[model samples]
Target: MKGKDKCKALKEIRAKIAEENDIEYVVSECKHKGDCKGTCPKCEAELIYLEKELEKRRSLGKRVCVTGLAVGMAATVAGCTPASVIDPIVEFFGGGIGTEDLAGAAQPPEPVMGEVEPPIETLDGEVEYVPDSENSSEEDCSGEDCSEENGSEENGSEDPNGGSEDGKGDNDIPDLAGEALPPEEF
Candidate 1:
């Protein structure tokens, strides 16, 4: 993307974000906060002037910053110390009223989930599942002396070759039973 195109795209996104965040609503909320003992004319005038300035910027196709919105919504009135500590926001509605918490006011939208094709493909045009070697332990056969955790023989007198209690293998041919299995048994 070219620089000009990217800038235009960002400006478009900024307009959308500004509209969705609704700076006017936040300003109204701030003005309604009960910190002002009465209708302070100074604070009201300052807020109204800031709102006009923000509106002018918007009309001129400029991107509105969340931080600026917070500051614009600030309510500074006389008889309130330096008056910079005052704000209309419920989150930081005290002497610390500033653009510090503006970032939290605007949250990004959540992602959407949808079905899609699998990423894998083979020469035969099918998705074949090949188990990973490191994680595969089902085929790990040590021998008859292995622990019963791997389903091997216990400490019983039965045949280590995996024969039944009646001294017969699973095939039931009744051959040489009660004997140790071959070293490389499957």
Candidate 2:
């Protein structure tokens, strides 16, 4: 339902609940903190529950409106209108929507000159048959602190686990191997 209608329905439900609780919807000093002057706690809780319900209904209505607008836009983008465009698409896809004579109804226009690039060619014996993917650019390997023109190597780091230049398990970090860790807490 629309937001206004849903809100009205919620208001009716609130009125019913208020009547059942012997609560008077007066313009008293109601701070809306589960406290109503000269009324029981049940009345205050019922009003709060009704308010939340009304808010949920309004939120749902807004979502439904937005979803409907999105569906409408999708339909337009998919060419749902203008039966001319749809019929050609169906015939082009071999659905045979129209006569067999006009098979080129949806044929795409010839691409403008130089708009499309020719595929890369590899000479049988003139050049090695290397796919474009196997080649790597310098930018692909040289990243932050890639010391040897490659990716980060945790094992070859400055830490002790990384073997030193002398081929020993030495590190530049402070030697705290003898220090004990803090005791584990529950």
Candidate 3:
């Protein structure tokens, strides 16, 4: 298409994208009129923005399509119905195929009488929670060990005098000698 035609198409695409994405774009009137080359800075910037947004949406659409295709193929391979594969994708995309759309759809099979369900098992066969007498685990801290110890590292306590062994905790300020101190700035 010609430059003018392409620009027009892009504007239309941008308008559609804006509408779908709940965006608002106001078009300004061309001041150049007959002398307009259509490649003005404003038009070029808009063109770039629209192209990028379109590309982003196109990539997302492609990803969704690919995902849906893979899921459909996997469902088919797993002997699942098309509706089983398609319904979830439709729901996910905020769309739905109504009962009317699924005319002559296969009904799910009813459970047979006297059907004994198999017990669920883990990789190690049956999962049981048996406690070992040797390695007894405690859920909570209790007894003398549970109580906070004096001068413990966790409590940040260094000495019984509330300071380091040589005296002065982190919050203590040191006395500055007159000559050692820097002169006050005016």
Candidate 4:
């Protein structure tokens, strides 16, 4: 594309990016109670400042990219081949020069292969097991009574009503207050 068209496209893309960034920032700030309709005045003011800064950065990036493209194109058209354009393409893509191209030159000596030595052992001996001094196993409790040494039984077998000491069942079902309701005829 022509330089002017490229610049226009770049500027449009930059403007879109800036708009998206500002929208995301606004959404995040509003979520944190920054927008005027949401909560504090100070946060709203800060949001406005951040939006302006984003706009300024976007404008600058577009201007710089366009200017660089224009300068590059002009230089190329004037027969000034830039090292930036040529060097990378040549180094990465160009095939190596053939041996036929260097036909009468003295060739470098072939690389010599050294003998492979066996790998040395690094460890002196087998691993030894070290028992931990503070290894304490947890005790298994019987169903009858598993209370700790200082206090009451863990189960509620001592309660006469077959309920807990607090009068609550394990399933937490409340006791019926009076006689059960009569069965429905259906």
- Tens-digit per-residue lDDT, 65-154, candidate 4: 112222332223235547675677575565233122134632222212353422322212222222132122112121223233212233
Question: Which residue pairs in candidate 1 collide?
Answer: 30-88, 85-95
Query: Lowest-scoring 10 consecutive residues by lDDT in candidate 2?
Result: 61-70
Expressed as tens digits, the lDDT of each residue in 1-186 for candidate 2 is: 222233344445555533432233332222332211223333334454433332332322211111122232112323344775577765578652222224443322222334553222211211112223323422332334334432123322112223235744321222323878899999
Please rank every candidate by TM-score, starting with the best.
Answer: 3, 1, 2, 4
Task: Count steric clashes of candidate 3.
Answer: 0
1-186: candidate 3 lDDT, tens digit per residue = 223343455456545544443223455544433222223455544544443333333323211111121232111223444785577765667542222214554222222346543332212122222224212322222233423321234433222234345633232222322456677899
Going through the candidates in the order shown, the clash numbers are 2, 0, 0, 0
Candidate 1 lDDT, tens digit per residue, 1-186? 222233334334434433543332121222232122222333334333334433433333334343442333323443534545545374334422222324453222211235342232111221222224412322332233323322212311122224346633222122322888669946
Q: Which runs of model 2 end up more than 4 angstroms from their true locations?
A: 26-46, 49-186
Q: Model 1 RMSD to the real structure?
A: 34.8
The all-Cα superposition gives candidate 4 an RMSD in Å to the true structure of 35.1
TM-score of 4: 0.15
Residue 94, model 1: lDDT of 44
* Global CA lDDT computed for model 4: 0.31
